[model samples]
Every structure is written in structure tokens, then in C-alpha cells.
Target: MIDNSVRTLFLLKHSPYPPMGGAPLRNWQNIKAMMQLGEVAVFSVSSYKSPRSREYPPGVSLWKDYSTGDILKERSLIRKISDRLWWMRLYGYPEADQFYGDRVAQELQRLLVEFAPNIVVFEEIWLYRYLKIIKPYGCCLIYDAHNIEKSLRRDISVSEHKPPFVSSLSGIKTAIIEGYLVQQVDQIWVCSQQEAHLLQKLYRQIPPTHIVANGVNIADYHSDRISHSLPTDGLEPNHFTAIFTATFSYYPNSVAAQILIGQIYPQLRKFYPNCRLILAGHSPTPYMKESAQEDSGIIVTGKASDIRPYLTAASVVIVPLLKGGGTRLKILEAFAAHRPVVSTTKGAEGLNVRDGEHLLIRDKVEDIVAGVCQLWSDSSLGRKLAESAYKLVQQEYSSTAVRQQVEQAVLQLLPSDFRF
Candidate 1:
């Protein structure tokens, strides 16, 4: 059923192989879906070094992979300063322009000529700057929006107590950029219906928008498939463990970690003295590490090769996110691992999960603590929630379900005579 005539190229802000974080994981899934539609070539930029060997699909090719270090190494001091200043003046942040420069543009132009892709997928709005380079090639453009950038930026800035003027300026610039990108792309893909509506509300003249919800590979997190070799240093089988997993470097996750360590865990420990909390992810801030050192009950795993073990060891998974955009994959992963979940409303945003049905949704620290304790005391309730959540994920958020959604979206972009 593959369309041999279609050539699809992905322009990503980060490398998707060995997908550890949300953005990379989403990109990885999208790539896999595209591979089913046609031949795929990826041109990605990453902050980290490329893996020596990536397990890419048989026919797919990583045409260009550049590290931020690789891109910066060749630039002179004067050029770097000029570029930063220019980007700041226009966009209020340099990230949008980070992957765009004469060198990258020329290489992209060459790629367009040689690959001659029929469809070009922009992984996120950050890569929208490269749209001009691909437009001349007359390829169908698809913008996969990971988050509603303007709204997320505004919310994060306000939560972090950034100056009002500065936050407003940044938000305005983001809206302008995102608005243009949405209009320019042939089709737009968002994480949820909530995001789709937000986009419609924000911009008047947007192209067709589709909801492509975030999902997990169910088999990866299945209890029978995972081995329980909990990676952290100190843990006993008797302890009631509450775990929160995320890329801790992200602003919302960092805030949630601080809240868990400073507020929630302390309160929960008083009720159940044997309670232990695990903050498992990459790039724990210095404060989080120090807190872990001070509290024996808290274990901070800086980065793990696999997160499945931690999920398997958990008595319950907690998400105390205060501000963030898009649906959370952490909750889905927890459900897939057959663990009960307690998430804040913001933490569980964009998911079609009901409070107390799939997972308990709580906003306040005390309430979240109570929810965790409830799960610990009543084993049957936890089992019920986990079972319901597992069923929900299988029906809607599994890899197979998401792949079908992506396939349908892509089919709509093809010519009327074309068939998949």
C-alpha cells in the first residue's frame, strides 16, 4: 500500500533517534508514520552529538544531522553576535533562527534539488524559518505543532514571574511568527482538539488543522515486557513509591520537581512514613540534586537509559505540573505500565481522561497527596484506575491508533487520484 511516488522530507529542530524526551519522541513517531506513506529523509539539528548508530527504518535516510556545536564552531565572533542581535530584534528570542543561516539554507536548497520531495514536514514552528527554502521546490508543506508556542511562552513567563512588558513582547512576537507559519503550511497538525480550537481562535486564515494526539508504543510499557531493575541507588520493596517522570530540564517539569520535593512529598511522608518519591528524568536542576542529597526518601535519577523500570517499580505515578501545553505522554506511559496516576489539571490537559475514572486529577498539593495515599491504602481502587487507563490508552493513545490518525491526515494532502 506504500506510495512509491511520494518523497517526504522532515525538517526537525532536534534529532529524533533514541527518543528520550517528549519532542524527540513525537518526532520519532511522526517519522515512523511518514515512512508508511512514502520514502522519508530527515534533516535535523540537535544540541547533543549524533548517535554512532541510529536504528532508523530500512528505507529512511538521515540526510543531514547537525549539532548546535557543529553549527556554532564555524561562525566567527562578529557573525555570531550579529546573528543573535538580528534574531533578538525581530523575534525576541534566538531559537527560531538558530537552525537558519546561509550555510544551512544552501545545504537545504541542495537537498530540495536532489531529494525533490513531494511533501516537506516541519517538525515544529521553530523550523518554519526554513519554509522559504522549500517553497520554491513546490512541495506540500505540513507544520506539526508540538505546542501552541505563544500561549505556552506566555503562561511559562507569567508563572516564572517574568516582567510583564518582556513577557508581552515575547508573546506578541511568537504569535506573529506562529500565525504566519500556520497560514503558509498546506496542512497543520496539533496534539489535541483543544490546541486545534486555540489555533482557530488565534488566527483567522489558517489552513486545514488536524488533531494528531500524542501516544506511546503500548508494547514498550507493557508490564510483562518491562524488567524491574530500578536504576536508582536507594530503594526497598516495602516502600510506597510515588514517581514523576519527565525531561526535567523543561520549565514545567522543573517547577513540578521542586513542588514534589519541597511541598507534596513532605506532606505525604507525614501521613505514610514509609513513602518514597522518585523524580526520574534527564537534566535535574542543581536544586533538585541538592534536595535529593538532603532527603533519603527522595531519589533523583539524572538520566536513565530506559524509564520503563522506574514505572514498573512505582506504587503510583504523580504529575504536579503547574503550567504546560499539550497532552502529557508521561500519564499515558504510566497507564501503559499499569500504574495508577494522580495528575494536576494542567498536567493532564488535552487528554480525554476523566478524573477518578482513568486517573485521579488533583490541583492542590494537599489533594494530590491525599490521592496518592488513597491509591496506597486501597489496592483495588488503584487496580481499577490502572485497568481503565490501560483500556483507554489501547483504544485511543496507542501507537497503532495514532498511526491511523497520521495516515488519514497525510492522505488528505495527496492528490484526489492518489491512493494509499
Candidate 2:
């Protein structure tokens, strides 16, 4: 029998809203779908604000806040280290700030006693500290691990200096604590198999982890939409265009940008005279900004209210990302729009894509140039790749697959007596 009673669910995250990458988008989309089942309360944090953050579904309840400015500005070594220790206690590694200060932890304890939930989904591992507050309430706990945090951390450690190793004592301590957190979750909802395998090898001996690849919101990422608001620093669709968008400040993104502009783009332009690569994202540094100025072929547009215009206009969407974990939602977004992709093997690591069938893969700069030239010269090939990519998303990576996974994960975790 199905129970339609409004079963409350609590969601927690290490970061705040209007999700950028896979984690936040999944968070947002999950919340929207779960509301159809019953009532939901999202306990989340964000350091920044945007108009989009305020846009929540009709019945969705929120316990989210803007990240603390004071928490971010703490520069004193003694205090920072102290906060990190305190923060890491909450998770394995400390986030910017703890969600429940001394009072809130007590408040959550009190609330659990009051509005008991059927399920509780922790958006990231950091909030797993609240497990005690949750588990005792007899509610299901779903750890929506956006990525396998520990392995992803290790990958970042070597790929670039961003997620650098913690050094001797701290590194050992971090690994020990992180491994334990994954073990406690009732069910871990992971993004990719590569990440799941890394976690299972590190911690679990049995019981398979769930693989829920991130999805693209094909409805919002529409075609034929141009932003009249954008200043349009003289961009045209007529040229042979290549587009990539991400929070460029990210480690893999910065690394990929440097390599693409520094090495690959030059060779790409040599063969195809009219080609231009657009670096479209938020907060592009001075070096990235200059790439467009120096090369008429390379245009860097810093932040767009709606990136669909750039995606819709481009002939190719290139993801040269060399580091990171989980499916590149950026690639999925482009694929959703039927844009042909040219990526490094590492960039297209997990999304269940083919080398030459769904996408054209290249590790060498010369090969990258050849791939681009091939797409540029052959209009038929570009359309074929684009059509094939879109079909891939529709068949396997749709929002329907994502929402169904959440439903089953929640059902498996919840107590049988609980109604939803």
C-alpha cells in the first residue's frame, strides 16, 4: 500500500544554493522531485548569493543560509587551525564553517524529536556529523556523495597543487577519518563508477554502492535563446567556434584552460584559420582574459546570466579538463544541446561515452587540432556527432533516471512503518 501522508525529509550540504557543478544541480533537482512525494526541509549553506538561490519549488521548505564572511576571513594561524580541527571533527576535513554551532546542534536534536522524518539525505559528507542526531530518530539516511571525496581529494593532490596532500600527520589523520565516514552511511549515492570503485577499495569489502550519474536539465538549457542583456563583446556564430564553460577558478578548469590556450589552440588555429575558442565562465583570471585579446581566435567571456546562448551558438563544445572526479556536467550540458564534443580522454572519463562514436577523443595537441579540423571541414560529421551526443543523454542520463534512483535509495533506507 502507498501512503500519501506528507513525510518530511531533511537535506544537508557543505555549500550553499543555485548549484553550479554536479553536486548542487543534483541537490536542486532532487529537492524539486522529492516535493512530489511529500514535504521536504533542505538544510544547506552557501557563501555567496544570486537571484537563483531564492527560487525554490512551491512546497519545498528550506533551512539554508549564506556562508559566513567572518568564517572566511579568519587568517590567524592558531584560530584557523583550531577552526579546521573543529570543522574536520564535523566531517573528516573541515569545511569553511560548521552548520550547527553549539546551539544549532542542540536545536536539530530538539527538532528531530518534534517533526520526525521518514528520511534524511545529507548532501555532502561533511554533514555526516549530524548522523547521531538523525539515526536515533529512526529515519533513513541517504548520503548523496557528489563524488567519492577521499579519492577525489587524492586525485586532486597529484593532478595539480590545488588539493595538495595534507603532509605527514594531517594527511594520515584525514584519510583515517574520511574512510570511517563512508562506512557509516546507510546507502551511498555516488556519481560515477570510477569514484565508487575507489571508495569500495578503500573501505568496503561487500555490498555494492549505487552509481547515480549527474543529469542535465534539458528544459532550461534550451536552444535559439540569445541574451540581449549580454554586452556581446563582438561574438559571432559564423566563425568556427569552440566553447567550454565552468567555474574557471577550479583547479582542473584552470589547468585545462592553461593547456588549451597555451598549447592546443595555437595548433588548432594554424590548420583552421577561422576557428575561435571561447572560455565562458565566472571569474576568469587576468591570464585567461588576455588570451582573447592576444588571439582573435580565443574569446574569454567572464560569467553569463544564461550560458545557453554561447552553447547554442557554438559549432563545438570542448572539454579539455585533465583532472577531477565524477561526470563532467559541463559535457552533459553540451551533449543535451546536441553540440559535438572534443575532449581529452581524462575529461570524458566517466559519463559512459565512446571514443570516436559519441565523442572525438584526443590526448595530444596535434590530434586535438586534427579532431577540430575534421569537425570544421565536415558539416555532416559535426551534425552526426551532435545528434549522437543528444541521443546518448536522452537514453541514459535523463532526469527520470536520477529521480527514480533517489526514490529507491530513500525507500531502502526508511523504516518499513514510515509513510511517504
Candidate 3:
């Protein structure tokens, strides 16, 4: 007989609270959904350790915070060097912030015995190594593939024009690891059907997969409707403000910011001098800060406590991402906020939104500029698009719709007689 009160342990690299990007927002929403089904606890490493670290999700039964330093100290000098080299060569990121292995395994072992969770959900592939520890416990393992990481890296390699030799080696290693993990996990959760199909082609032994597209917390956005508050600082009164929000640390988003200020803004300025561009998100690269300082019309809000104020203030939101995997949560947020969006075709890739009805989709610089200009010039058109997008989000991408999918998927993995 299946247990009615099932328990889950969710593992992620970073705390899902204070979500600033697409992936974190998904993590946050997924965790919220998990709580409604049964008891839930989170295991995560601190991105930055502090005495004043805030509690996430408020009333979770357990929240364990591990340190990267603990993991590093357990490795030999040569091993550390080798790992550093591998990370740099594979992901082009030298920092070992997201790496977890044997050092974490011991703590994980203790947690597993104490929690005795029936289900263990990993946030992404990087946490796949933990499966070794999880397997002996016989807990059902779910690998939430945020995107086909191997393919995403390959795209990044090609986009950044990495050396052919380096790209080939990285691609081979990534594929081998990802393929191995796909075979090991009991279930694989993907964000889109396209990603699921792609993974199946890439890995012949792929496990049963489910599509759980990222959703917006409609309440988070709707709260804005009730509150007419705007940020006291960092926002200037502009006649027409076109805003783009993305975590600046990501290469694609950083490139998009550059494109916005460099390529698109020039064309846009020719027609509307009073218009301004706002790039808001965490970790503003030095180049972005420098570019913003150089151009008076561009405002870079490095990071903000809340994004709704910016969204509420935007005349139009733009998603000019050139390349990335998975659906864009930013678009969903725009829709929830009832803000008209102008995005590149790639930006709206996995969303079930119509271009003309929900948001405008444009690819080239000229077309992107035209879309934003059209929205700014035509308030009625913007209102229609925003209203349509909001309705679509309410019916499709709302937390209620997505949480049900998650609940069914979780139940399917549980014992046959499992009750709510």
C-alpha cells in the first residue's frame, strides 16, 4: 500500500527564494507546488554564506545550507586543479561555485537517513552526481532537466566561437555524462516537448519524461494591481520606456543587453529621443555598467529587491535573447504583469503564446526596433496585446495549472495505492 502522506527532499544548487531569473523562478514555483502535495524540505548550498541569511519559503520543515569551502577542503591539490580545468574547459566558467561531490555525499547520507524521503528531486544535471548516494536509499529519483545542458553548452560554444578542438572535447564529455545520467534516473522532468524529444534523440536510454513548463506566480504579479507603489530610486520619468530584465551574469542575457544598448537603441533613438532603455537584473558586468554610464539614455539597475516596480513602470518589455534553451520565464512574468512584450522568435520559443495576440515576435534588429516603436506609439495595440497575454497566462501558465501537472507526475511515481 502507498503512503498517503508522502515526503519529498528537493535538492538545488541555490536557494529558490529571492528568485531573479528564469531557472530560479521555476525552482521557486516547483517547490511551492511540492509543498501542497506533501511534506517538503530543501537542501541547498549557500551562494554566499552570511549570518543574516533569510529563511526561504517561510515554514519548511528543514532547510540545510552547505558551504563550497567544505567541499573544496576535502579535495587534493591535484584533484582541485583537475576539477578547475575541467569546469573551465567544459562550461567556460572557472569558478567552482556549483560543484558538489564526495564532500557533500556524507552530509547527504545523514540527511537521507534522517529524512527517509520517498522521493528525491534534483533541480538539474549538475546535481546528478548525488544520484549515487540517493540510489542505495531506494528513494525514487527525479532529474529535473532545466534544459538539455549538453546541447545548451554546445550552442553557447558555437555562439561564443570557441576553438573547434575545445568545443569538440567539451561536447563529447558533456554528452557522455548527460547520457549516463539519463539512464540512471527514474524520471526526467523537462520544460518543453521539444526539449523532451531532443533529449530522447540524444540519449537512447532516456527515462520516462514529463513536461513541466515554468509558470508564473500570478499572485505575485496581481499584487501589483492592488498596489500602485513605484520604486523611489533608480527609476526616471521617461515618455516611452522599453525595459529588458535578465540575470546579467548569463552570456546570452549580457549579449542581449549589449545588443539593446548598442544595436537596437541607436535605431530606436532616431525616432524617439525621449524614450529610455532599462536593463534590470542581478550582477551587472563591468562592461554593462560602463556602457550604461557612457550612454545617458540607458539605465542599468544592477539588482533590485523587487522586479514588479520595474515591470509596472515599463511602457514595453523586450526579450531580445539570441540563444538559450528552455522557455523564457520572463515572458510569463510580462504576461502576468499585463505588460505588452516584444521578443525575438527564439525568446518565445517554447511558450504557447501567439505572436500577434499575446506578444510581438521579431528577430532582426530592424524588426525588434519596429515592434517596440509600434507598441510605444500605439497604446491601444499595447493594451490589446497585454490583455490577451494576461488572459492566456491566467488560463495556461498560472500556478494552478502547473501545480496540477506536478502533482499528477509526483503521484504517478509514488506507490500504486498512494492517496492524496
Best by TM-score: 1
Model 3 local distance difference test score: 0.79
Pairs of colliding residues, candidate 2: 15-45, 16-45, 16-46, 46-67
Per-candidate TM equals 0.93, 0.85, 0.92
Against the correct fold, how does model 2 do in TM-score? 0.85
lDDT of 2 by residue, 123-149 (tens): 765565567667777765666777666
* Candidates in descending TM-score order: 1, 3, 2
- State the weakest 10-residue window (summed lDDT) of model 1: 48-57
* Candidate 1: tens digits of C-alpha lDDT, residues 297-343: 88888777688898877889999999978548889889999999999
The residue-by-residue lDDT of candidate 3 on 287-362, one tens digit each, is 8799888987788887776788888778899999888775488889889998899999888887887889999999
**How much is the lDDT of residue 330 in candidate 1?**
89
lDDT, candidate 1, at 63: 62
